[model samples]
Target: MAERIFIDTQSANAMIDNGSAYVIDSTLLQNENSRIKHFENRIRGAKYFSIAEIRDTSAPLSLAWPTFQQFTEAMIKIRLPNDGKAVIVYDQTGFGTAARGWAMLKYFGYPNVFILDGGLPKWVAEGRPTETGEYELNFTDPVDWRQYLVTEHHEMRVLIDTVEQIVNQKNSGDNRFAIWDPRPPNMFQAGSIPTAVNLPASTFFNADKTIKSPEEVRELLQQHGLGGEVITSCMKGINASLGYALQKYSGNDHAHIYTGSFEEWKKLKG
Candidate 1:
């Protein structure tokens, strides 16, 4: 099994205490006011990052995947430590939109990245400390971002071209890869890539939105007939990122995300 990329609240707390971790508050879909309130009551030292900065702004949707240059430059804004400290990414829930940041960082070959298990809700439930203040970034010197440019595992995400190859392989009786759609049931029922399995982000989590154990997730994917490789997709791509992250948490290193999912597919291939 691939080592899990999830960190529990206790472990997260310890990392914070030891000053060996950087926490990214990747929570989106909220404004500065609401975000401020949440930040005022959030885990200490959590840095806020807009999902758009690391996206392909030219793409049809505001949430499109970032180009290599866009991603590297935008990621520099967060100023993640390259000194080997752990980096934890989380959204409103532990396993939601935050997966995009976690996934993108991993795709670029950052080794210490992790998704917080259970997220803020679980942290509060466990009675962890919360701090309030203006978020700050200490950009002592302009980083040589060239060192941090995503250098490997570009295959962590697949484009339309790659999806085409997978489709052809499937048509030729290849069963090693399974397409996964993480959209809601209603949207998924309306239309989806043929042979794609419906394994929405919700299916990989408990009622509380915290992800299930790796063992449970693996079994659930198996129940849905997913094999070794999983290609997760959705209307856009943010929601499906959580599914791809879940696959990694469950030890399927071969899992991938189709960043330009159904919408892009329809535009070019429909």
Candidate 2:
């Protein structure tokens, strides 16, 4: 396991310069227009990987985790580093998208993955130099990553059936679990899973896009009286992973992600 889940921009820059790390830009790309402009130039030599490419799009909820084989193929296509190199992932929005990448890599048993704290915005704000153009994937022969993958990590994910069971349990006055909704306050207000508490993921990040310290995160969750086994959800699962990551960093190893989230929940209700 990696000693830490995040790296400061200065540390990331030094790692890149020393060729000890491989940077991954996880920002969403649409028609070649990405939220992180000049991304290739901004982080010279950074590879690009779309979160969609590793998702189960055909499912009722598009953000659901990919099948094992699907995940393997995506990893190969991206030519992920396996030579004991540190893999650092970042996105335009602080840890939002990047945390999903971190979670995916961790679930697959990548031992040295980390999120670039504050992401691209913070890097650029620090006046770091960026390059332009797409960085090509360095294809390597495929290795069976399944051997290294954490198969039991799936146990931490909740599907529609389990979610329904949880709601029932809550209704029956069992509070063994707590659902943390990381969607915006308004979106959470519009509709959310029954018994889910709003704890917008944005609250876990500093204004500059860096994640709050573990102590701060612990304090915030404690202030809200949220504890025990926590299940994080959002409109989809992207932001939910951020909440889960925070919980894990704050010493809550039992934190889980409701991958189907409100998207599948609403469909089942309908």
Candidate 3:
């Protein structure tokens, strides 16, 4: 697996000036237009691409990963860079959906992907330069997308079968993995996969939306005694991805995301 990369506003701005970084706005479409416009304007030359552009909308949970072919198409449509440029994904809400975008790109074999710590909100708070209007990508050939697809890592995702196996292990008292719930305390208290532990994703960020220091994140994970293979889940997979990213950021490469997560788990149980 490639090392997860994260950058502060200063580093991101430097990369942008050199034309080696491609900024992706991963904010949800339903976000207020003014908010979206403000974000776009703040990051000059940033391209807008939502998770919806690459997800399988027909899935019950809606955030399901796309098929290989579908992913290829989306990459072409989004005009992703083909020159091995680094990707910086960001959203209005800290690293929420932006983490998902980073995970997707990494799963697809893109090595230089990074998330903008604190996202657009932090950038604005820092009083960065702002420019209005949209930016366009110069489309690359669809065939180029295939060169970057890494099949082995793609299979590392935690699917329903893996979740079922985890449940079985818990029932038999032979558990080999830990499940991390990134939802709120109330949601975790109401119900979750049996034996799953609550570790709200919010704990990983500061009040200003910036992520906690690596030492702080590592200490928090250690305090929970969470180790070895761990799977992260939430109502959908958005927050879960953030958990997975946080784990990776803390140097736990074995961390994975339960893509179906709580939504699919509930459906399956019913």
Candidate 4:
């Protein structure tokens, strides 16, 4: 069976209105646009957590995986539904930082998660409503959200040691897994681990930023020798999560993200 990957803006809006869904904007408010913090408006009732917010602050690394303690604490702060509910993630574009939020939620065991196909741009194009102003840190929930705090889900992520072991296995004869690097080719070729391949995440998106069709995605991944279980890695976990989402959308659910990515890998390996 195929794993679900995306939700259209209309269906997503309906769910958000009916209180069956939570929307998260996982834009990575840095690098090329570091000064731009909150956007002017967001999907109605959407809680915004730029990738930087969910990032692990326990150390000096960039966007390292959040610890269980950090994740729970942040969710509590967001007043995320205590009861299990659908979470729809998005970024400025559909395929960028949204995958990070999706990956994190899926890793933590949220079963009904999807990325908003085409993201906020698509939502606005269809005349969906949005809310203005900076996010309120003290927004109160009217439901029993007080009781639905999450338990940490640890099964979908691989650590530095696990990645090393995979490299060793590949150097020998194992081909059961592949590390799918989604960065630019030059960046990948310059310094990537053994058994990793360049499969840039950008190829999975359409011109308007919506994800490509499942058929197209399958072809692209297959062409790159990406099948079965995969570990998606990049400079940070950002692009890695995109690869994970692409695979899941293409019906291959065995993919995992090396959440610390090459940044963490290099640090630990050194």
Candidate 5:
């Protein structure tokens, strides 16, 4: 078993005070583009923290499109002291963003990474300290992390054509084809790709935002009819990443995450 890759806000605070960590926020959940202004002043003279925003764009799923190399490059170029460990803190209900970011780091071959558990919502609710204003990032040369790339795994992606191929196989009487929808049952769009089972990503976490045990995850997979090559997706791509992590960690390597998800589906069919 690999190390537990997620932490809580208190644990994250301790890490900042003692160990090394990085803060990443997914732009999708942010109410305003100016939300970055919240952390500007507190991090002004800070030496160890680095912040970044992952842009969510509507595109076809392909590992070639958003390579792990690009993500690692951005992290490196920002030069937040690589004290051999990094942890990403997200907002309360935005668990998907931190999980997705942590998964990307692992996919790129970076070992020591973690996500701040409970996210920002829990942090504020618990009366934890927070900084305000926009944080500036100093551009610096990123270390060569090519050796840590996990982009070679074809199983990590499922594109539009892949779904078409799967549907074709199903029409040809291939019962092995299966789809796993990681959104709430209601959120599962009216017309789905073909043969997908609904398995909300929320199933993978408790109210406290910790990863469930392997047995628990396996049960959820079975309950949702997630056998064979499961294509996981949510509204966009964040929650689907959590679905991917749960499946992969539960010993299902054949699971592929559909990055475009419902967002791309509606656009293409419209």
Candidate 6:
């Protein structure tokens, strides 16, 4: 069986203390301010071991590159004067930035990664626990992952392409890919990529945002040609990540997300 992923905070804390699992706070990047403030106030001086701080700034290349290689290497270089410990993440919410980071780590071949459920809000609402303050760390290595690693937006293979790619390919007679847009019909914007079908992300989730039943999910995928090469995107990448999650959960194992998404589209348009 696949490993069970947990989202509850108390359960996460117990697992961490007992050394059974690592935890990730997969809240959105835009929402971190309030969450971290709560963590600082309520947790009775809880000291976080390993936390990922993701900010909302474009890199020199306009990607989330800061957390990709330099951040990981820093973690590796720092030998805390203490024994080995579990890594934890504290994420604020906006567009699943932290959650996406956790997924990226898993994609990079890390053995274990998990996101904090309900993030800081859920933790406070349950009256469970909290911690505070900015963390202090010193970097020793200046290695950059881009030197050895490259993330090709076009090469990811799982993302559904824009209408532009579809039209171009159709004109060229390649005709091998299909597009699926997971946004709501109204928000789908004016000119969908040619050959693209609509499949709003909302239909795949319950009112609470959890996934729907397998039959329903399968139906959606089947309507959109699930078995074919799949790529997904939304306004930024949040809806796309949810779409990617549903695709993977629904047995479309090869689904990919166009991380820059329509946000990139508008930039290119201008």
Best by TM-score: 4
lDDT of 5 by residue, 133-183 (tens): 443455664455643334344557788788777878988888686777777
What's the distance in Å from true for residue 141, model 5? 7.7
TM-score (C-alpha) between model 5 and the true structure: 0.72
Residue 117, model 3, lDDT: 86
Off by over 4 Å in 6: 1-14, 29-68, 74-98, 116-127, 137-167, 170-176, 183-187, 190-198, 213-216, 224-227, 266-270
TM-score of each: 0.87, 0.88, 0.87, 0.89, 0.72, 0.61
Q: Each model's number of backbone clashes?
A: 0, 5, 0, 1, 11, 16
Question: Against the true structure, whose lDDT is highest?
Answer: 4
Report model 6's TM-score to 2 decimal places.
0.61
> What's the true lDDT of residue 97 in model 3?
78
Candidate 2 C-alpha lDDT tens digits along 182-270: 77899899888899989887887888878888888888987775656788888778778877777877777767888778888898875
Q: After superposition, how far is residue 51 of candidate 4 from its true place, in Å?
A: 2.5
C-alpha-based local distance difference test score of model 5: 0.60
Off by over 4 Å in 1: 30-40, 136-150, 168-174
The model with the greater lDDT, 1 or 3, is 1
Off by over 4 Å in 3: 1-4, 29-42, 135-152, 189-191
Window of ten residues with lowest summed lDDT in model 1: 29-38
Q: Write model 1 residue lDDT over 74-129, tens digit each, in one string.
A: 66766764556778887765566788888777776777888888888888888898
* Cα TM-score of candidate 2: 0.88
TM-score of 1: 0.87
What are the lDDT figures for the candidates, one per model?
A: 0.77, 0.77, 0.76, 0.79, 0.60, 0.51
Lowest-sum lDDT 10-residue window in model 4: 30-39
> How displaced is residue 5 in candidate 5, in Å?
4.2
Q: Where is model 5 more than 4 Å wrong at Cα?
A: 1-5, 8-13, 30-34, 37-65, 68-73, 80-83, 92-96, 125-129, 138-154, 208-211, 265-270
